[model samples]
Every structure is written in structure tokens, then in C-alpha cells.
Target: MDLSDLKRLGHRSGTGGWGLGGLHETGLEEVRPVGVGGPWAASGTRASDAGEPGNSTAIAALIRDALSADQVVVREVSALTGGAIHAHHAIDLRAEGGTVPGDSAWVIRFPADPSFRIGHPPDVEAAVMRRAARVGVPVPEVLKTGQARAPGSVAMDRPYLIMRRVVGRAVASELVGLGTADGVRVGRRAGEVLGRLHGIAPDAGVVDGLIPPPEDPAGARLANLSRALDATGAVEPGLEWVLAWLTRNRPAPVPPRLVHGDFRSGNLMIDGGSGKARLVAVLDWEFARWSDPHEDLGWLSAPCWRYGRRDRPVGGFADWASFEAGYRAAGGVAIEPARLRFWQVLALLNWAIIALGQAGRFRRDRPETLDLGLTGWRLPELLFEMLRATAPEARAEGADAPPPASDAVVLPAPVPGVEDLLHAVRRALSNGLPAGPEEMGLLINAIGIAERATAAGGMARAGADWGDRARSIRRDGIPAGRSAAHHGRLLAETRARLTLANPRYLIALGLD
Candidate 1:
């Protein structure tokens, strides 16, 4: 879609669209608003300073201290888009003296909020990147890293990692829009990169400080999901059923390998400058860990990561055959279909929990963030997929079919209706208001939720006590020959949620 269309409908687009690829990246911030000026646009604002939190002066000083340089001149520091938990700034600097590189472009990364840190610290990430680079993986080189400390202790106030910036587009929409030829080529390269990454032996020093793979991967993951669900304190019968199904169908254990926990389209930096899209660097190693290699494969192929291109299973670019070929050509082990499917289901479950956690984080720590609040609303979508994937009927008859269409609910329009009120506010905001893309997205989503909830008559449709049913299923087992009824119940319950969370999603999937 064009920029104007994105601005009007808040649809998914390359630069600023509110749909799938736009707001879905794990921790990436929303794109800058359309028509907004770049960092250098405003008068009196020096190129060397973008008014971002990490100012050039402090960064230059930090570089000077780290390199023991006599002088360091920071030419510019501009905020890069797409980092939710961490803030990323591109730094251009020239240094003179002690082991200094003459001139360079680098990226400085640190937690947006120090208290909301996830995964390993900066030092460990630096070490992991170094190790990955040593093993032939395309990754940025870490120049310096700082540990989190009390205020006023250092020039860089937060724990941070500085690395040489690699030139490439990491946006998912842009990558997926590259068409079939480039998709296959990029997908193959990604597979090759991942193959090499997973080739890192379990005994390697890189495994230090990283969470090791569990003895029983499926069981451990199921238990973790159960605990996370409990923590959310939200009743999720569908998830419970999926949990029980997973418990029964645990895959046989395999040897552990280095897994890029969040390996997917958005996290991959692709360079198309040479005419063909190629994987230049694998980004976002914060979630890297020791686990079943299939975990990485499944995550790469997960439907959610496809950016709406479900046909191309491997990151919305290439088929499994091509990706598998690349992996094997790079000396990776052969993949088993059953194991891959198992991990794919687990991946969805893991993502659902993550969505809950992000929503919780928004409520508890960052109430002002509309993005996190929206993430919580995504659980229904995630859980719907989980139910479809793990339902007993799906196991018998294939699970690849699209969800069947259901009748759309019609609602009465009352005086001063909530949906109408939200639509009016949205129009006012979209017309001439000084709202940013983030604010616009929030308003659009709020309107969508209001409209859907209004149509559905409420947030949910009253029916069976799903929580009790879930408990029984988890305790006993899925009833034999009742797969049809089970599937129907799942569809009904999930559709109710989707109505409130995203009616467009239901329509797009042919469920409405």
C-alpha cells in the first residue's frame, strides 16, 4: 500500500503502517510518522546532535575513554528505528590516538529503561557476538561495552554495547516484498547463516552465561508456559488444551545447539545493494540461547514472522526445501518434519506468553506505551493459531486448512455509541492534529477494539466454563472421537476473542 493509504487506514507499509510487519517486531519501536522531518530537518539543530537521550558529547567522551584516545570527535548521532526494549543510535565519529580507528560508523545500544532489561547483559552479548563472528556468522563487531551502574558513575549512564554498524535494511515488510526470487535467495543465505550458528558446539565457551537447553525440551517448555500463564492470571482454556496435547506428543530429545531464539525476518539484516538480497548480518542476539536446533528452524518459519505471506513458510520468502538445502549444504544436520512441526507449535505458545508479558510490563512498568498494551491484545490471535495447530482433529486431518468463515455479528447503533465516538476522535486525530505515527496507531487500534467489541456486544460471548473444561482436559485427556466438537468449541471461543481484539484479522484469515 502507498503512504497515503497507510496514513488513512493505518495499514502495514514499509516505513509507517500499523498492520502486521509494522508493529510486530519484538522490541523495535514504531516507525517515525509520515511527513515528519528527519533528525536534521529542524533549524538550529546541529547534525552532530539529534536531541536523543544519548547525546553526541557524552558518547564521544565514552569512546575516548574506552579507546584511550587523545581526542574523539562525534560527527553525528541519530536515532535508528525499531528497538522496543533497547534504544539504538547510529554514531559517526573520528578518533585520534591510542588504538583508534581514524573514522568509523558505529551503533550504540542500551536498554530504553535500565530496569526493564531482558536476556543477558551488554558484556555477555558482546562476547556472544564475538564468538559468533569467530564461527563465520555475519554479525556486527563489538567495539566496546559497559555494565549497568548507578547514576553518575559513567559517561554512558546505562549498560551499553557499541558495535560497527552494518549497512542493510532490517525491515520485515521490505524484505518480504522483495518477491519470490530474492526471497528464495535471501532465505537460502539465512539458512546457511543459521546452519553455521547452530554448528557451535554445546561445549564451546560461547555457551557461558547463556541458558542451556533443557534435558526434555518439550516438557520444560510446557512447564514454563504453564507457569507464565499462571503468572498472567488469565484463564486460557485453549492454551491449556494445547499444553496437554504437547505433553502427550513430546518429541524425542536431540542434542543441543546454539539457537537464535528470535531468528526471523525482521531480525535479519539483508543487503540488496548488489541486486540480490543476501543476508549480511544476523541481528538481535539478546535472545540467543542453547536449545534444540529445530527451535531456530521453527521460529524462522513461524507464521507470525511471515509478515502475512503464509505461502512462503521460510520467513515469507522461500519454501522449506530450499532452506533445508541451504542448511545441509552448510554442513547442518538433516531436519525431521515431526520435530520441526512440534517446535513450530511450541514457538506459537512461547510467543503468546511473551505477548502476555509485554502487556503486563506495559501495565506495571511502562503504562504510557501504547505498543505494549496492543501486544497484550495479540494473545487471542496467538492462542487461536495454537488451538488450530494442536487441536485433536488437526492432528488427524491436516491443520494447514484456513479457518472456515462464520457469520459476522450485527450490532444496534445507540445514541452516542462508543464506536462512533471513537471514530470521531480518530478522524480528528488523523485530520490535522499533531499526533505522531505512534499516537495515530494507538488511536486506530483503540477504534478497532471498540468497534469489534461493540459488534460482538461485549468482550466475550458467554458459554461453557472454558477454565473448568481446560482443567479437565489437562488432568484427563482429549476425549476420543470428539475432535469435531472440540474443534468447534475452540473456534467459537477464539472467534469471540478475535472479535474484540481484531475483527480485520478474522476477516483477513477468512474466519469472518
Candidate 2:
């Protein structure tokens, strides 16, 4: 199954080194070798291997078994973006040695979950891929597919997938909001790209809820909610109820089109130095299908990809007008605002549930899981704020200041600083203040306020970051990699605050 000679083919074509041109410099070393198992790591070290040569050889055999392709090679695997859970790597192979006419750079994606869920066949991913491609969302042409090679687990675990490597850069985590002109360009381009995707003719639809969940609806609900709370520890109040309302009151579909259900910043990639800034590939087609085109539109506007820009609805590109314009330019029909708004609310609600799952995973000693869990707390609160602002009047009582209810929880002075409530809460958590509902409520309020402050800071922060990111992009080009990653962090933090303020004042009606 070894395909070492595959290196001689064309793997060395302009590979290696930062940004797209010279906008920024990614200090990354190690230009990943093709036909190897790992791309982020050195040439031959497999992320799945533990310094065991024999393990990789066995993996090669497994690849051959899974795919109809002639040969496969496992070199090494490297963790991508936050080095969080999922690991992405390069797999090089050829049809008949180097002599074969056909070839591909296989991407091996695996979960780094310490305890992976089980009870799924190896072909589930393959099946998802096949189904998705049929409806027009792009998937790596599957030469082969697989589940985790659990040697000693009681429950079969750690499902992994291998497919043709996508031709563009990994544009997920970094592509959230437009920060630099490059990001803005990328962000706006992403808008145009997704608009086109929403144009695909209707074929089918999906609602699997990506990560595995308990069989029952409640379990799934709890699982997703826990995930969000654990990751962010915040909530977007009232969004859940509104989404439920929208789900029930859906105004039927305007039209059906191929929808990449999970279309988000991290899922799509753009070719940088190649110019054009056109989306080189549509990815993560596991959620792809034909359905209400507005679903994709809503996902585009989801809080999950806010990249901290609550003001610009579509990945911080501009307003809804720009997004809608771009969509129309890309050939999608103008969708009903009411229907599309329902999906927008629906996207945040979906994310809110998932945030809880993240919290559950990390609340234990899982250090890696902690950040993911932290995200859970943020989105729920943010989404809650969105719903609150959208329907501020929903909470009936006199609109003007009435006597504060004794039960209306608010924290007494514990922190010395006026604005550093988060620091105070952190100190409390560290000192074992035992976070109960009361303490948690105060923490949430404090976070909401801080979030507002940060978002107010974005108008200023954006100016500062533009120079840094632009330098990186210029040094490298649009594929500014880590430069974009840095920007992504800033925006996420800022948008986190914007959601807290419920700025648009839309949630005011909910008070009634």
C-alpha cells in the first residue's frame, strides 16, 4: 500500500510558507509532505500513531481495505486550529505505484475525543458523503472511509474519516468575521460562495444534529444544551422559545436548494495566492442536502460564526442587504424575510443546544474540553440576549422602572474594580465560592455587561487589528493562516459582548 513515489508526481507544487503572498508571515515550519499520514506534523509522524512504525503500516493496510484505490501511505498527522479535538492530516496515494494516471491527496480527519462515542458502522460517513454529493454540496471524493480502529474498547469508538484532500485552505475558525481587508474580502467572498451554494436545486434535507446524541429527544436536547453551556457557559435567552414558535409556525418553503447544513467559517476554504479569492471548495458535506434554502442563509447568519460581529449579520461582511444581494447575485431566489428570519433564529437555537454538550464534556477534568465547554456558556447567553432584544416586551410588567423584585437576582459587591466582574468571578471560582444558581446568575449578568463593553470596543479594535492582519496577508496573501486566526479570536470576544447588550433592541417586544 506504500505510495512513496507519489511524492515525485506533483506534491511539491508551490507548497509551504505563510499567508497567501506577503501580507503576514506564519511562523510555521515543516511544509507537510504529501502521501504522508499527517500534514500538520512533520513529514512522517502520524497523529494517530504513537511513535510506532508498525502501527502506521497496519493503518496503510486498513486504508487499502477501506478504499478501492490501489495504494495508500501513512506518514504522519498534525493537529489543526487550536489543536483542539479534530486532527487533520495529509494522505498521499496513487492508482498503480507512481505509474498510475490517477492520483489524489487524501485528507484524514479524526476526532481527538478521549472517550469517543460508539455504535455506528464504518460506512456511516461514506453514506453521508455519498448522499451529500448527490445534492451539490462538495465532499472530498471518497476513495475510502472508516470508523475508529478501537482495539481494546468495550464500545466501538473514535470514528475517523479519510477522503480526497480539498484543494483550498482550511477557512473555518479564522473566517468568522471580516477583520482585515483580506478578511473582509474573504468574508464577503464567503458570502458570495455560500449564496451560490444555496442556489443548488432542491433534492433532500438533513437534521441529524452532527454529533451523536442520546436516542430520545430530551436526551438529545440535554446533550446539546449541556454542550453549549459547558463550552460557553452563557445563554441567548428567549431564542429557544422563539425558534420553537418559528418551527411550529413555519411559512412553508419559498423553494428548495442544495444546502450545506453545516456551512460555517471553519468549513469552507479559499485559495489565497491564486488570487480571485473565489471559494476553492465547498466542504463538510455530511450535512449537505436539498431543503429550504433559507436554512443555509440562517446558518450563515448564526451566532456560532459571529466572529464577534453582531452588527454585520453575515460573517461580518455587511448587513442583510449585502448578504441577500450576494445570494441573489449568486442566483438564489429572494427568500421571504419572515421565513429566513425563522431560520436565523433557528441557527442560534441549534448552537445553543450544542453548547451544553460542550460544557458536559469539559466540566470534568478534560482540559481540552474546558475551552469547548466555555463556549457553551457564552452562546446561550448571547442567543438569549438576541431573543430578549428581539422580543423585549414578552416579559410583561411595567416597562418603566418598577420596584425591583426581591427574587430578581443581582450580585452584591465582591469585586474591587468597576469593570472587572469577570476577574472577580474567576477569583470566586478559584477560592471555591461554590457556584449555585444565584452565583451563576450574577456571573451571567456580569458577563453580559462585559460583552457589551467589548463589542463597543470592536469599532476601535478593528482598526488596530487591520494593520496586523493586513501585514500578515501582504507577507503571505489571503491565505494568511495564523494571522487570520489571531483576528478570529479578537472578533469572537467582541461579538460575545455585542450579544450581551441585545443591541438592536429587537428583543424588547419579547417582554410582553
Candidate 3:
């Protein structure tokens, strides 16, 4: 298998700077050893300077002062990967006279960049998590939340949240690799947790400050994506078709409930022991809001979250049947097939939109992160994933013949074979080059992009073909012959490009 194939089994890329080779390591805000927590100490800064370890020392001191401790010692400060949108670190704290009473591991989360803060502010997020935890959702205990710079904390310039760090890994690759039975166990547990989360009453005040639960949840979501797409100024006909399809097949309104907007594999934490795996925590509540419960269900079951274990719909680890059983057992309302499909489609589109934003961050913001650029390279595959999900029904409705297998198209070539150069660099990074997981993920991702570029000529041709067919349908009428033809061609092109982009996905879906 090539690098792309290997990457399919890897964790989602981290938002960190990248390089082909040479030394690259994710800097900690402080180099506090795991077991030691003491007074403030400075450390090196990263390129962004936003996640400097020195700031971690300040945070440790801040926590110390907040807790009314004589002195706060940061035992360990380690940057935690996987929060692509936020910069975070796990700080093992030792407080002398803090209100909390003793030393413990805490997580401090701040924006990846100073200019952009996600959903709610730190205080708001802490409040939401506290409410969710009270309602029986497995979440970390929020210790403190504020924007005020604590005494002795000098590097902090924005709001931050300090929460008890829960154990277990959030890495998808590890969770997906759990033994089948163990994986299913984890999935069922996650389903139960989500069901309980949805069971929280709307009057619980969790949605305060966020937009009120929209009367038309699906429409509201689609409109949000439409706005995001508009902002991107990048045209995607497949995405446009998805928008139209969503409008045409809108599901009946369901009462809005608490939805974990980004509920999926990577966001969940799993504990494994004695040959079994269990859901430890349901995290990343930045996107949590009042929405249809099925929205959470669909997002959890989306193909993208499954990694390569596509057979297990609930996650990459358990089937929908098991997941649904757990959900029902936990008092979650029955999931409607149509509504589930609707949200699942929306989940794909929403993820694609987020990926676009990631790419845009790299292109527009010029962050030192290379993962953003690699994320941009995934647009075609992401759109095609949406098409694959939406096009099959139209095929049954009498669309035209499937387009021919993607044919080779010649394109400009770089001096050294691009794929080879990428592979070599990736090898260097993988083989003893000092780089953190985040940087390595980016390098691996770059290699995948380079490999996929080999098929760019074919993918571009297929996209143009589909775009023409799509425009023809748009110009004609809604239910005209051209619509079916367009759908069929769209499916064919999506499958062809998807085959090149991620054949593992097709095989996982039994399409291979």
C-alpha cells in the first residue's frame, strides 16, 4: 500500500507546522516533567507563539493563584494533539494550598491562533461541559474558566479553560483497531452516552448564548453550510448538487434536542483493558447545541468517522444495529431511517465544508501548519464522498449509463517524479527524523496528496465532465432526462475519483 493507504488508517492530521525532513517537534508551553509540579518556569515558543510552553508556566501559576495556593508548580506540560481547531496542553499540576486540595492533571485549551476562537468562549464551554456532565454525559470536570490572566501567568493573553484531564486515548486509529468485540463494546457504550446526552431537557440552559433551536433544524444547518461555502468563494458543483438534493429530500421536522454537532470517533475517548474497550468520555463540546437528536446519531454513523472500518456504522467499531440497540436501551428515541439518512448526508457535507475551512486557513491565513494545505487537497475526495452517498438512489431511478472508467490524462510533470520526491521526504520524516505526531501526520498527508496528484489529471477531467452534466440539468428542469443523466454521471465520476482517492473507503462500503 502507498502512503495514502497507510494514512487512511492513521489519526486525523493535526494542525501543526510541517517540513519534509530535518528537526520538527511540537513545542510544549513548558517542559514540566509528568510528575513534577512547582513554581513557574519559562520554556521555548512555537512558530505561532500562541502555544508557547512559557505560557503554560503562566497558566500553572494562574491556576495556583486561582486555587489560593501558596505556589503552583507545573509538574508536566505536554501539548495534546487531535484538537485540530484548538491549541491544548495537558498540565500536571501540584498546588500547595489550592482550593482543589491536591495535585492533578488538568487540560488548558485556547485558540490555535489568537484571531479565531471556536463556538463559545472558554467560560461558556466550561459551563456547557459542566451542564452536560451533570446530565450524565461523560465529560471532563471543568475546574475553572476565565479570560483574566492569573497572577504569575504572563504568556496568556486570552481566555482559557482548565479542566480535569480524563484518561484514555482519543486517537481513531487505536480505537478502530480494538478487537472486533471490544470495538463493538466501545461503540455501544458511546451510543449509550450519546443517548443519555440527547435525553437532556432543553430547559437545562445548555443552549444559552447559542442560537435558539431552529424550527427547521435541517434547513438551518444547510443554510449555515451555504453561507460558509459562499464565504470560501470556491465553486463546487458536487457540493451544489448536494445542497439541492438536501432541499428536495428534506425530512419532516423533528423536535430539537441536544446534539453533539461533531460527535464522531476522534472526538470520543476509549479506555481499553482486559481485552475490552469502553467509552471513557464524550468530548469537544464546542459544536454542541440544540438540534435534532438524529443529527447526532447520523453524525456518529457517518462514513468519514468510521476510518476504514466502514462495516461498523456506529463508529469504525460497531454496527448501527448494535448502536441503535444501545441507544434505545438508553432511552434515545427511535431513529427514523429517512431522517437518519438526511443527517448523514448533511454530516458529509458539513465535514467537507469544515475541511474547506481548514484548507482556507492555510491558503488565506498562511499559518505555519502544512496539515491545512493537505486538508485542502482532500476537497475532491470529500465532495465525491458526498456524491457517492447521494447518487445511488438516482441511479435506480433510471439515470444514464455510468461514465466509463477514468481514463489517463497527461499533465505537466515536475523535475523529479513528484510522487517519488514526496515518498522520499516522507521516508526521511518517518525514519528517525525528530518530529511530533502532528508534524508527521502532516508529512504523511503531504505524501498522500502527492500520490493523489498523480491522478489529478483524471480527477480534473471527471470533475469537468460532471460539472457540465450538472449545469445541463440545472439549465433544463428538475425532473428532466438530464437530471438522471447528471446523477448517473455524477455517481460514476465520484466512484472513479473516490477509487483513486480512497479505495479503502469503497472496499469498506463493499463497493470495491
Candidate 4:
């Protein structure tokens, strides 16, 4: 789930929207490659030789025992990528004429690290999938769900859930390039599928009480976001401003529904062929919950989730009108424009908090993931979007804010410039090192972190000035003529950040 290669995964071709999609398809179709196995293995090393606990050998043994069949032989295990919270691997095995078929490809999902869990546990995720499937939500079929080390066994330490392999790429970069017509078709289909998902009632024994239902969904989210922001220990003026705006403009509440908390382009599996793309499966139920149905709509339509195709509001692939038509056509509730915007603003704030947490993973949690570290640096764009959505006055008359004070200074690291250093390191990871699938994934993350780090100096300086301006705005109130100037400053700072972190997206969005 390297957010960096989203565009490269899919592309347009004359023979229809379908192309050789997915970086994992170079090895496994559904998942990305795992990082190099050991603490420090050079490129091209095998997982078995890397000496990690989740090495192919240990994983194969764990799978064999979980099946409890003597005839089963685990042949090969390759680490797959694209999961932010879990370590995914494709398990190739021979059943040898047992109840389980022979030469089958299965997936093993295990915790990436014990410290980075925010959703349901493995066992609960399995049960929720089952319940969701019972209600016609298309999910991969779960084969077995178990902890890595069952009570007395001293085997693997992580809990794992196994499922039959399903083909299709969820990476938006790969999906969006499937041609405009194909993109529309996939978007509508996804909207319809999401509507169907939201229509499901949480009456099943398994889903009931799975997670404590928030009595006041919006308030609960705000409270959680407040805590999350506090945990970040960094002052985000945009986040603070948006939180205040949301509090002041609270809308009439609605009943909660089963919501796929993270239902964006990257979480969908698109099966492409003959110039058409169909959503074959919905992935990532980690954030599934009982909440306002509008939350899902807003999340799906959020500017951040749109990836590079901001014009197409629905997951960056289809128009809001078509997506809403598909949703309402599928017997789901109607979209309230104001409510949707409220949730969209909330989604921005939520992602901002999550981004801070991702950065924290590298900073404090010792995950050392490039993905997490880079995510922290991309906050300016999200904050910029928040300013535009919730405080339109900030963009009034297109005026520009005053430049940063002369006192502004950023800690300068030695050697090549940050951007140059990042680009050099990323290039090295991509071509210099021969890495295993696990190592490859880590490399992807490393490149992403480097990409963001390229903007560290600018972001630090801009943030300091932005914080000062925000205080003045709060004290003097957003002045009628000055609001536009403030917005200009926000946009300029955001664009500067994206130039280093995601310059391609800026070019695509015409912001460059």
C-alpha cells in the first residue's frame, strides 16, 4: 500500500482501459512486495535467508498447523504489500488431495507491528467480513482465522487471518487510467456497491457490539480527533480552525448505519477486461463501524481521497451526480449537500490526524517505515483543503497574505539539499539495491519518506508563520478583506510542500 505508485499501477491503452496493472502483478497480483526480511538485508535476498520471525519458513509452518491437515505442504511464501496495518503474504501450497484443493494461492494477514492497531482485531475482522458477506457485501472468502501462536505452541507471535486469493487492483493510479469511460463505469459500480453495503443492518450476532456504537457520532469523532491531534504534539492551525468551524456549524443529526470507514479508490478491487472495469471486491474493513451514512459519502467524495482527479469528486473517478445516482438507485439514503460537506471537512481533519500519527510511527514508534515518515510531511495539502472547504472567506478576493518575517529560519541539514538528497536516496532504492519483496516494499516506503523530507525546510518555516497568523485571526477575527490573503498564503505554502512530496499530483491537478 505504498501511496506513491498509485498512478503507475494502472494506465490507458488503445485496446481498452485494461493494461498490465499492479506492481504486485510483477509477482503476486493482489498484494505489494514485502520489505527485505531481516533488520538489514541487501536487495534480492530471499525471505528464508533473511532471518526474520515472519520468514517464509515460519509462516508456512504456521499455515500448515492452522489447517490441521497432515497432507498439506506449504511450498512457497512471498510477502505481499499494500496493507498499511497488516503484513500480507501470498501462501502457495499443495493440498495433496485433501478437503482443501491442491496448488492453491491464499493470503495471510498478520499485524505489521503490535503498536499500530486502531481497528478491529484479526478475529473480529474475520467475523465482520463473514457477516458483511452474508448481507451481500463482496469480500474475499476467509479460509481460517487464528492467532499465530495458539496457546502452548510457541510459534509465530502475530495473529493472522487467511483468505482465498482474489484478483483485481485497488491502487487508484492503476484503476483511473483504465480510460475515462471505464473509470466512470467503475466509479458508478463502486458507488452502487457502497450503497448496498450501507443498506445492511447490524442485526447479526457477530456484528452486534463488535465495537461500541458512538452515541453522538459526530461529537465522538471530534473528541477522538482532539485526542489524536493532542497526541501529535504539534500545533496545526488549519486543524484547529476547522475543528472550531465544525463545532459552530453542527448540523441536524441522523441515524447511524454500517459504514465502510475507508471506502476510497485504493480500497477497491477493480477487475478490468475488454475496455471495462468492474469492482470485484471491497477491501480493508479495518475501519468498519456504525456511524452516519453520510460519513462514508463524504469520505468517498473528500478532496484528499480524490487522489489527483479532484474534478471527479467521487473517489477521483466519477462525477458526484453519477455517484449519488448510483447510491440512491441502490436503495440507500439520499445525500444532503450540507451534511456531506460537514463530513467531508471532518474527513480532512481525520486524515490530518492520521497523517500526524503516521509520521509519529517513524518518529516515536520505531516502525522506521518511510511511508509513515512521509505521510507526516504531507500535512500542508490537507490543511490547505480544509481551509478552502470550511472557511471560504479565507479565499476572499484572491488577496495574498504577507510574506514570512525575516526572523524565519529552518534547521539546515548538511550536504546535498533535502530535496536533492531525498531524490538521490529514492533513486538508489529503486535501482541500486536488489531487494526481496519485503525489502522492496520498505524501499517504496523509504522513497515516499524521502519525497516528503524534500519539503521539510519549507514546511517548517511556513508552519511557524501560519501558526502566528492563525493566532492573529483568532484574536482579531478573520477580517473580510484579509481572509483572501490568508487563504493565498495557505495555498502557496501547500503548493510548496506538494512540490517536493507529490509534485506529480500538483502537475496533474494543474496546481503546479
Off by over 4 Å in 3: 1-57, 70-73, 150-154, 204-207, 360-370, 392-399, 402-478, 503-512
Write candidate 2's Cα lDDT for 50-154 as tens digits: 324444454455555656445654544233332223445555554444322255456655554434322222355466556555544455676655565645431
Regarding lDDT, does 3 or 4 come out ahead?
3
Best-fitting candidate, measured by lDDT?
1
Winning model by TM-score: 1
RMSD each, Å: 8.0, 16.1, 8.2, 8.6
lDDT of 3 by residue, 1-512 (tens): 11221122122233342111101122111111111111111122134432355666576665776678887777767665443345666677777775776777777776555454446676666667777787678888877877745342333476777777777766555666678788668767787888888887677455566567778888877777766655554555567778888877888777777777667766677776747678877777766778889888887787666654557777676777777777888889788898888888887776666555545555444444454444444454566667766764546732574664456521111112234336445555556763667556555545554566575652332346544544543344245446666666556655565555445555645668
Lowest summed lDDT window (length 10), candidate 1:
32-41
At residue 110, what lDDT does model 2 achieve?
Answer: 57
What's the number of clashes in each of the models?
5, 102, 8, 15
TM-score of each: 0.80, 0.56, 0.77, 0.74
Expressed as tens digits, the lDDT of each residue in 1-512 for candidate 4 is: 11121111111111111111111112211211121111111112234321244476566766666665567776666666454345677777887544575677777777665444446676777777777787677788878877676332223467777887787666765654567777778777777877887786655464844765567888777766766566555554556667776776666667777887777776778776747788778777766888888888988888776655667888777877677777777778878888889899988887666556444434443332243344454565676678778656434523565443332222111112244435535554556574456445445544554545543543233355556665665455545555566556555545554455445555555656
Query: Distance (Å) between predicted and true CA of 209, model 2?
Result: 15
TM-score of candidate 2 to 2 decimals:
0.56
Model 4's alpha-carbon lDDT is: 0.58
lDDT of 1 by residue, 194-254 (tens): 8888888778555567766678766766776677666554556667777777777778888
Which 10-residue window in model 4 sums to the lowest lDDT?
Answer: 11-20
Which has the higher lDDT value, candidate number 1 or candidate number 2?
A: 1
